[model samples]
Target: MTTIATPTTLYDPPPSFALVSPFLYRSSVPTSSHLPYLVPLHLKTLLSLGPELPSKALQQWCELQNVRLVHLGRKRDVVGEASTWKPVQEELVKEGLQVLLSRENAPCLVVDPSGVHEVGILIGCLRKLQRWTLSAIFAEYASLAGSQSRDIEEQFIELFDTDLVVIPPLENRIDGVRDVVNDPPLLAPPQ
Candidate 1:
């Protein structure tokens, strides 16, 4: 017989948690206290962005839950100069997009330390790929970002070349993007 795990307290999601799609979610770095709330999501993968290393506790939780954690950012040395830190690279974001588009990685959580800049930029680029208007994309970004939004991130999203994003083949594609891939916008475009 299988035993179901019951939560001892109310569900408390991580800071800035929100759904990106049916199978994709975005949020700030989750703490041990937030682990219980993640149970219902049945996450298959955790795509971590930014330069910081995940806590040992998070690693253990992922191991126990059978969730694959993929960290794309390079680690910053403790003694490294903060002024030398660079913005997230395009190559890494493209790789992350590929991970998100794969059906096998569905029910994935894309997280960063703050979930304001990195995650927001990624989601904005995704919206562009989905043919969403720039205004709409920026609106969504601003809604979550509040006062923390940056013009540089928005510029990156605007300049992002969706042509470079290689979508997975039909069989490997996620349900959310399947329709988008099949029925692309015509010359007239959506009003």
Candidate 2:
């Protein structure tokens, strides 16, 4: 039996800034599946990120708070390479994007677990939309650990030539053991 976490609190829904949300769906399948529980996405906001990256904790947090989590990738490569992160195949990009376009009126949040390179790819996909707006972007900040973090944050800002906020790392307390996501976006409602 799959155990779904019960929601805890309420948060103001972010406006249709660009895309992202919460509601819940229960399934008989094991929770080990990477595919997140899909809520009705019609005109609903969504949050997406690079492949893998253990976003389940953040996803659950969003669900409990009524924020929708959109699963965009199914493979590790989709997250982009950590060393030379770049966009994947056109088909892969389109596959992930189909979810976003499915709800044209919806706003989305693109969280990059692999840092600037993945975010760059995400931005590239958004640009292809012809008529899409990026309300806000939150880059993952590994920590206050010397220059490495700064370099990654700077790269992320420079990639889009926009201001970027660094979100603290997220730990997967939901699953057994302490699995930590190096960089997970902070869940704050867009103004």
Candidate 3:
């Protein structure tokens, strides 16, 4: 249920995976002046590495060089509108994450397919996630999600297998596709 707002820098995947540069590695981008490298021009990035690595630095370098990185979210919308991602999610369940590159939110999204899906019931999750280095996150918001939310979450998991990490987006608003998630429980996940 977590939603993220980030600096607008995104990375676009190219046609060939072999030809793509290592995300942390530097390569020149052609422009009016000679720049040794630029941040990725796409929206999402999935990495074998954790978020604490030098990705923020790399993004900044790109900005300095006049490259803009539009952030594709792990928790943000694919497009400004909520409608674009419904079919995409179904395709994601069928094909896994490789299909993310071709979506309307291209150049801004990335994901790791390895062990990305897991679910287990844990009561005190904030401490657990904070202390443990898990690939994904999950938790309940206080007494657990309401019946409607629980059902919606089950539907989501049926469509896509993934670990449940509850960040509690907001409470009671009807958006499409993931409208269920936008309205968090009356209680947010507490510390």
Candidate 4:
């Protein structure tokens, strides 16, 4: 049986610009590189950091929220107002969101994760239009919990570059990210 924690049941951390609410930060990654926490990422928005474009909207959002994007690739040419925070497009592709922009050889910023099913459909359609390689499971939760939440969170210290936080619902705050990912896959069936 899956125990789903309702929105009302979440532990509301004291307000510290850290007690992230759902309505705030779209791709709400934490500023601090703290351990033992959950970090919620808006998979779709993350996809936006792509082939490269004027990331004014994305940059402004990060700056205002005081969050940092952990770049996974070597830095590239950062022209204009957007600061290139390194690249994680490779990881995104690995997660199964076929980056067509990379294939088209065009510079675009296309980021949106409606759902795994939705992403799958997108990938399937893209396959028809171009020669695209299959990606790994794309839109799964990046959880930081276990039978002992703290132990699981501790284990992720090296994996996650930011303070892991949860944002509930599809609202994309700290709540949704941790709320479902705290244990196993939130919607997975039982043994």
Candidate 5:
């Protein structure tokens, strides 16, 4: 009797993993098991958010994989106060956006511990910068974040100023960057 060989699956994506665009992905903090799933992404950079530094093992993994690891988290001034946890800073989000926009950082992953609020907020702002309507933005956020979504985060996205997000020159940016830069949203003249 002849036996056939079976193929095994290798990819096991981290919790809440989703593609933000052709090159950008968002997910929760990847554990050791999830690391293998990341191999196929060929990520050039991993942008971590939240108030905690990445685990040493994760840093080592990034180094071994030849991926640049960037952490944009800062400890809270008033610790131990859950209510005092502030929203991700606008400036910080803008800086993260700049990183994602760069062609050099293509195929990047943005991760936070829960992969809900901070990542949601960043993506929401990006949608605004990309000229998405507020309803559509909230719908996407709600879908990804589920019940974990916060009104404050939604408020932040509503109030975010897209004009303040500085875009790199066309040549330095990823291919889709020009879609937002070349076409300005139409505005009705002041009555």
Candidate 6:
């Protein structure tokens, strides 16, 4: 009697990797211009903020830049209720983040143009992101003295190996610091 061998199909093989640009190894995305390179035109960006809406000027800028605005400010649609993002925060970490990692899919940028207390929690939720760094985190009113805000910055430094860049805002607000758009330096890992 002869025995025959059968092909095994218990487990699927991993997908074959494709060639990526050598320049991609660099810390930051290679661009023609030196100024902070915003997300590529190919990808649409979601600009999220607390319950309040962005200013008319800012909204116009985002529109011109082709960014989609999302309001993650309120826990629910009810009015006069305490504004909280607890409900959708988990979904953002699980579903929202994965989508951003996909180049074919557009990424997101959470900003608190009015800069309120909730901004700290937003930053904390953002810290959980693994695949991609936040495109930007603009806080129109930065309260660095607060432990929560400082913790957020510390987390960025530990994970990204670079300080959160504070980008100047278009218009000045109550305080001298117009905004706190923390753009990742996109720097190479230190040798």
Per-model TM-score, in order, reads: 0.83, 0.36, 0.20, 0.21, 0.84, 0.35
lDDT of 6 by residue, 1-191 (tens): 99898856333211211111211101111122311233333225443434556556546656776766555544334554335423223333333333333343334443443232333333433333322234333231133323334444434323432123222332321111222244334566788
The C-alpha stretches of model 1 lying farther than 4 A from their native spots are 1-8, 75-86, 178-191
RMSD of 5: 4.8
lDDT of 5 by residue, 42-155 (tens): 999999887788888899999999999988876332355446434767666887888888899988999999999888998898887777889999999999999898989999
Local distance difference test, per candidate? 0.84, 0.37, 0.29, 0.28, 0.84, 0.35
Q: For model 1, name the residue pairs that clash.
A: none
Say which candidate scores most in TM-score.
5
Error of 4 at 57 (Å): 3.3
The reply for model 2, stretches above 4 Å from the true place, is 1-44, 76-86, 131-191
Order the numbered candidates by lDDT, best leading: 5, 1, 2, 6, 3, 4
Off by over 4 Å in 3: 1-17, 20-49, 53-56, 65-99, 102-191
Q: Candidate 3's error at 29, in angstroms?
A: 16
Evaluate residue 31 in candidate 1 and report its C-alpha lDDT on the 0 to 100 scale: 98
> Which tens-of-lDDT digit does each residue in 25-64 have in candidate 4?
1122222331112223322222232233324654555445
Candidates sorted on TM-score, descending: 5, 1, 2, 6, 4, 3
lDDT of 5 at 135: 99
136: Cα error in model 6, Å: 20
Stretches of model 4 off by over 4 angstroms after superposition: 1-49, 70-92, 95-191
Displacement of the residue 76 alpha carbon in candidate 4, Å? 12
Pick by TM-score: 1 or 2, better one: 1
- Model 1: per-residue Cα lDDT over 59-154, one tens digit each: 899999999999876633224443543355677678888888889998999999998888898888888877789999999999999999988888
